[model samples]
Target: MGKIVFKRLVEVQILHDYFLTMGDGISFFQRNKKEKEELLTQRINRGLYSAGSIFKISPITANKLRDNKILFAETSSGFILGVEVDEVIEAGELRFKPVHDISKKLDLSFSLTTKLPFFKSFTNLELEKSLPSINYFTNKKATLLNENTVPAYTSMPLTKTAPAHQAGETYEMGTILDFGGTIREANQRTDGNDPAHWEDIDDRRFVTRADKVLLPHNFKIKFKDYQLVTQLEVSLEDTGNNKIKKIVKNSAEPFKDISLNFSKIDENDKDSPNIPSGIYYLNLKINGATEIVYSILLDNDLYDYQNFGVVELGFEEVNSPYSLLDTQGFLKTKIEAGGQKVSHPIFEIRLKNRRSYWRYKKNTDFTPSEIAATSNHLEVAASNILVAKKPKALTETLLPFKNGTNLLLPTPKVAGIRVENEKIYSDIHINQSNGLLKI
Candidate 1:
């Protein structure tokens, strides 16, 4: 397979005053010219060295350098000679003037091989002197010799500890890669990698599971009713530090139920408390005598009691002396009050096989509105016959029933009527006065 190559070409201008030679190396002027030439040469060499050093220490550059796939070159443009021309009128006579001079600027070009086509441009040679000096080899011996430091290898075999890279795995930017002593960062993420899809985080400054953090939680403890325990005491102690975060104590009259509540408190506002997620011990005392302890985990928000009341309904067949009735059913309903009282309750009965026979005229024997009209009649009949009363006080008005009890609902008067006919003609009409029908 062919190898990928990257090239960086840089060209900079150097002013004549910086590297011009005055005379040969013989007289005082000659010595000054030689010194100036030496200084200029040193500056140019340093600039080239700085540029190469910056790229050499790069992770990709170092890897390529190890494989002997890198190159560096520098070139200078030869002296450029040119002439300037101008039109002049000297002594009322038009004349053409020409002046010859050498350019006062020197062009220097530098080229370096890189693993990636990423480079910075320098407008002039002075800018190169401003580049910061970075010593990749920080060791005393390595710095003195102007050489890169190499790690000492051991005879022991190296073990592969890192897991193999899996497909679709993503890593976040600024992820550090430690190559024994040298460290580099994966700063670019132009590929299919995104920090949002990263699974694991090595930084402790970020929170991973926000829901697991401790927040304000409501708790309530109620003593059984009609018991000797009229007082209750509750306290929550942090298991890690044995610190008492919250405490509550309450008392009630004799034979009365006692309830104690505890929660995280914030003095400034009642929003949330600054609690840490951990295990806590909940201590409870009944009548300031009986003590009980329980362990609870407070990693998530919790509520002690149900918010909505529950209603349960049960149905059972009952014996009926009326032979015309197919079956008699009784409804047994129970309502359990929760944190709040329920003033109104709604009960719905659904027929699984109910179809739009009245609107669609599925039954040709019956009129289109027969089912709809009969439903209204049955509802009125049921309201008139069905009466709710307390089982103990049979004559009393309907009241809230907290416990399960049987309800007596009499059959409606319209239940025995046959709403559908066998084969009734559409034009048939009945004479109300004589009770005779014409078909």
Candidate 2:
């Protein structure tokens, strides 16, 4: 009886002609439930046709832990997914494991994530809201459970330190390091170098007093394909007001570990740029491939009067000679809360299949090639990003409020960024009272 009703529904609005058909004898369907709306995009129902080309995409704001089944289909413009999270489970500690075969490819973060049985995990949050205060551990001790309230802990002034490994040592060749210090250590983790397995390296975050000094020192960084000296430049500066000014430093480091001794530009050297001490920005220019990568550390704090910046690096692809990701290209920004503070900052942008996008931007090597971003202000063009395997359609937005606000309506909230597929729909809009929407 249920199957009869579903077949009737499929018959209600069937298309007369075929547009896309898979290898098997599956058919495509369409309806004029409002012809214009039908022309925009079609939703794939589970039982309407062969599930071969059937794609499913959940609404943008769906909680990933819901155990939603996200299967995708390929399209010329991009991929299409029909999402259904009807079988939701209780949200627990976030956990994900990278797909092994995908990792072996020249893809890093682009590696596919599978539902692995790890004990813990967390997602980057938009700046307006606090991340779920999970016990985040580094090379140190940790708390037993998740904290509901963000305890206000005072922070000590930050110090920039780089530790070099013994000479003649080589790592598995992963994310590049700026100081040539601690780059290999992150993937190696606290257990020390483990050629047995790999771990995701959390971006280093530091809180500092504006007047803190970053004394100069010598360090070594390993670059792939060529000697340490090919196409590398280091710029340290301030990026608080949404612009970049060279934080004038004098670096004459040219050899292997690229010594970085930054000193104030002298008056006699008026040509040198000047940098005031408040928040420091670290920028690195390097060639990026699947293997050769680097890391830039910045402040991941949410408190006011906090000084921070992120490490931004750019690299050229060895195969195509095209740039892959932005050098600090994707915006990781923060805004002041409405006279209130939160626990920690969430990453403003989320890129799905980030590595996959690089894999197929030029060729059709992969299927279901898509990239997803939940950001407040994202400009792919400025970053030279122009494509997403398919055109994205907004399903629904997930938003969080501040200062005990309960309502989730557009009237009171700011919609800072709206992007889909490869087109920019809405520009970033914000108010001092209400910063970019923490979506």
Candidate 3:
């Protein structure tokens, strides 16, 4: 019975759509009673959309409805709704709230207030009533504040000793002090130790007092390439008497070492008198140009080694030639003995003995003994060794000098021609099998 009822309902909905599609206007009105009531409410709401009306409610009545879900009101009421007679009367008594009182709330002193006039409406007041004028000048005069004034004196008297002036004490004009034999004028309140407040009368005396005296000592200056320098001159001057003393003047071959000999008047003159002890200015000149000037004090009581010692100076030349030859492999070089028949010329070969995975077979022909007797005799031989099985990179090499002074020539770079079948070859050739081989 339930199924039959549902089937009839479905059939009715189908027929309703069919009639509407067939241009039948009566089918829409034939809808269920509930749907017809919803259509009527929608038409009434459309009329109310464009209409508005005023509402009048008391504050107590609005407050009661504030909690209502459907028709609720906020705590803040409109001016016409919540206004009371007492509140209106109290607002009139104050007229305006003083903005100056806000300083107390902000935790500031009341004396620091801007002192602005309170706000007031001019409508209720009489037209002839005058308003309070604002005074912009609020600072008090220095005289009324009991502040010190500038003195009329031209100069202050000089003090023989350092003044013990306090930190905040004020002084009149012409206040001076002889602080540690230095005349300094007090430009402001000073602690007497600060140099900024004092004006220096003699700058030279201050410099002399601050100058450091040195003992008599030997000086030596070295040049990287002394051959390029055409002339070198050094002099000593007595600072007190301005007496100049010639130290060294070299116009010929410039020596590598420039040293001062205090025992003699000059570097080469041993018979001359020794230099006296005093403060002297040492001046170094290169190519007739002043290179440097140094003040030195010589004390006779101190020994030569006890005083300030040798000072080594060097000039950097970008174009100077390097003393060592940096290269890889063997090098063959000759040394000219100036056509003098030389016998048994010393030859040395240096190589780093690094560990290898496999031992390399040494070639006997390139040994130092065999190569020393070759037609192209080697005066000095140095090179990196590279085997066919083992390869290595070239590292920096330092040439050993004879007697720690005479520098030897650097080793030359050499490349191997070929090596195969337990034999070393100096040239390349094509073997019988048409394969490249060393011979």
Candidate 4:
């Protein structure tokens, strides 16, 4: 029925150990990371913990005394009854100075001399028990009071699709007449209707027009149908890692809303090649009701096999098999270390030349020897890559090769020969007679 005036009072309590706590002693205090530890504890202990005492006194009756630090006192009796002292300045105001001073004309008590600490270093020191409580008499009945200052509240409608507020924007609420059993407008209106009886309710009290009653009073709204979308675009990168990089984008799609769930797959062990490998997967979702799962695979570094072993071959070496063959049918070896005339299989085919020739050579008729050699080469390469067992050498030469295998080579299985393939799904075998690998 009346207006209520609300006054705010902020109390900051100073602890006796505040200065000591700030010194380089406590690990957290020195780090300054937990600076709020003492302050917050003081606030909780003095403010919230003493809410009943604070509400019953102070600005509610008397204001808090401001000094180097906050000081709480009782003003309900009108005079500032110093209950807690933070410094000598605060104690001086409460008449806690010595009575035997030169200016002894003022009224002072012996309690003040005994209660006040020696002047110099000071802190939040309580004197309630050391000093006697003084009763300061005052007239509370003389202060003017307004009975019409009662508390009133207005509902705050939740905003829907509203833009952020800008400077100078008007904040107004349309008037409402009886509907939700509550008066709608906030402040009193100026239009004169009831001269003697003025209700704290706004002048725009009743709905002025019939159309105004039908208009939606609340503007806030909630979405009815919502959805979410998440996608990961994967592309190949020509890097040493030879990995498929994925770009993830999540959205509610048309609605522009999305939710995400992140979890670590502790039990998921990935050993096979196909399934992507990662320690954790990010599960994306849309609104709590509708979900979109987006799996985030951890990234890793991988070395390319092609770049390796290239440096071992000299700079004069060609990059591909075709280039190597173009330079020389095969790498020329010393026939007899300073003698170039003799013959003893004086050259070896480079791996690059072999791969290039195999990649570009026209599909030709595969003789039985060529097929066998191709199979042997593929088996050996696979074994090297997967660390599997080497294939058995099945060499059958038409020439009178001693022991049925190549006489020059001691073992049918080329023990020293190292083979590797870079092409996708490549299978090659060596043919003894043809002396070449067939794919």
Candidate 5:
């Protein structure tokens, strides 16, 4: 019952990749359109908000802490809290040596401290609060933490996909497993026989902007067959032939999960058609369970929709209600320039968190209080993805779009996120067309 050690990249050095397809995502969304649409309603709503293909990374060489291996100072994008440093410096070539305001707030102006010829130093691992939580660079520590280890879900493809500046931003499906969910394979029976148990989500990711949404309803599933969670269905993935055609049966949930107080997304359905952000997936069959598929990014970043618009901060799925403003369970808020085209994509989704709670440390049979009383229960058990909408105005072109609505956007009424701290704090809803949205 003991073998969880994971965290490895061994080497690093990539130095370039800043792609952004579709004529630069359509000239960065027609010069950040959304000044309230209108270019004749964006040429009569074409492709709702087209633009795809994304990449953004720049690392030349890093990782070299020798010993057993563990050097991560300026390159380790998200979630790898192997924490426990004592010597691993390079903070990008040292240079902050200013001291004097009673010291503690961080000081280093660097006139020439220690060894600053080309940079290289070690011994400072108390990680001042894991160095500002994340977006790492280890504070720019440069690199060092080598002990070489891996096995606990070692998918390190860059922490299992979605970085490189999110390869061009656009996501939404939120059942909480980030990198847009859907990477299962280790669950040899929830832990008994030791299979590195994995599966967890709190569901609540909002880059917000509504054209009518309300059908997802908080489904924190763990699956062992809670009625297959009502045979759950949601479908919307055709990602150019990835296949997943139909079955969104109007906000599904009926096969049976005994309605653990279900809500199907805060009341919405006014003629549906306003789901045009991007990235969505969630489908489950329910037999012996584990069919899995979950992802959601929905950034209403219509090219910076408007002043750092969809700036979400903290809370990705645990007891949602915004994870109680995340005292520290994962709190982030980014979007540097204007809401979607910003430099902070919520720190690219809080730098892709996973530092700890590696889904209850990849459960080997549960015992950290029964895997924290059942891996944070986020029961969705079954669902689907994607929904695009367009042609709902300019006097309608030919309504009836449904089998997966095309012409470029036509899929509203998907509302499925909740983070209650009560008196409902925070607000932001802008639908533009379609309708209904009560979050």
Candidate 6:
């Protein structure tokens, strides 16, 4: 009887394909029929698919279904009835792991190959926002973690320092020691004899007021994405620090080992949408000592425009035989920021004539070549001489001094003045800033 009923339900395939497929078909007929519908209703309710439905089947029934000896068919009332089956299989035999199965099944369709590039790793924010920071070891004892932070704390002890502005200057925190000495003219010279003299231009001396001296607040910055091309412009003057100053004193010792660290204080800015963006704290350290520390709110618009000055290479036509003592040449280049024109200083170069070499008037066509030759000779001569005795007793800038006052070649060292053949090159002395030689 069950087999006959199931066979009859199977014949309703036409209805199942057309209308019975709409949603839960059994529920639709329940409203139309007020009285109980007997076996049809019970089967319909029991056949609903649910997570728990699999457990309701008896072991015998499950085995019969699995073996295809008995099956179910749909009726016009959206109900299932016992029916015969033609296929038999365990469910586990057909099941598969989703990820593995999809790849294996579609490998041919997807064209599996190792040529595809794999993503290496996410962008590093810390490296991108890297900036210089003042680092130092503790000189005193520490009780806490006793490691990294302790050394830093002791070196940059949180002592209050007099404001640089107290003397009408913006001072960094902790920089309490004020070198009250007036800005004396720094002597720039070198001796050719000593290898150390080549870097003598950087040596400098300053007297500071002990009472007013204090540690400057440290400043540092870390670029979240790009590198910050840092240039230090320190002004010991009252007008404020120069952002671009080429002269690094103390054999470049004063400018060495300067560190700055920057931290994002504002995380809400769209431009700096990450951790630190709009505002940040800057930590600056010099020679393992904290110089200044302060918070700075950055304006993206600040660098929108660049302030620049044009450097023009000034040249004058002169007779080839004439001694070109130290003719200054000039070229125009621009440096700008924030759409404003910046005041550019003067440009100059110092060169000494090596010898009087005559050029044929017919060969005037080689003007560029002649200019290059003349430039090279003057450079070689200027580099070989010792210091200018008139300028200073020490050889700040060694020049190629001639034996006689005639400025001739084969010149010996002026006894009182210590001069050597340093072999300075013109290209090495060419200053990019303001486009001129200071001497």
TM-scores for every candidate against the unseen true structure: 0.19, 0.20, 0.20, 0.12, 0.18, 0.18
Candidate 1 lDDT: 0.25
TM-score of 5: 0.18
Clashing pairs in 3: 155-174, 156-174, 156-175, 330-414, 331-412
RMSD of each: 42.7, 25.7, 48.8, 44.3, 26.3, 38.2
Query: Best candidate per lDDT, number?
Result: 3
Per-prediction tally of clashes: 0, 24, 5, 24, 72, 82
RMSD of 6: 38.2
Rank the models by lDDT, top first.
3, 1, 2, 5, 4, 6
Predictions in order: lDDT: 0.25, 0.24, 0.27, 0.21, 0.22, 0.21
Tens-digit per-residue lDDT, 1-439, candidate 4: 5432211111112112222232222311122213534543554554422222222222221111232122234221111212221112222231122111111121111111112122111211111111111111111111111112123222111111111221221212111223233223211121222222122232211112111111011111111132122332222222233333323443434433222211111114354233233322222222332222212222222111111100001113233321211132221211233433221110110000000111111134444553343442322322222111222211111111132243321222211222222111112233344334212
Q: Which stretches of candidate 1 lie over 4 Å from their true place?
A: 1-216, 252-262, 265-273, 299-439
Between candidates 1 and 2, the one scoring higher on lDDT is: 1
The reply for model 3, stretches above 4 Å from the true place, is 1-217, 224-230, 251-255, 266-272, 300-439
Worst 10 residues of 5 by lDDT: 118-127
The runs of at least 3 residues in candidate 2 whose Cα sits more than 4 Å from the true structure, single-residue gaps closed, are 1-196, 199-227, 241-254, 259-261, 265-274, 287-439
Q: Which candidate number would show the highest TM-score if scored against the true structure?
A: 3
Winner on TM-score between 1 and 5 is 1
lDDT of 5: 0.22
Q: Residue-wise lDDT of candidate 6 within 357-421, one digit each (tens)?
A: 11112211323433343342332223322222212111112333233333421212222221122
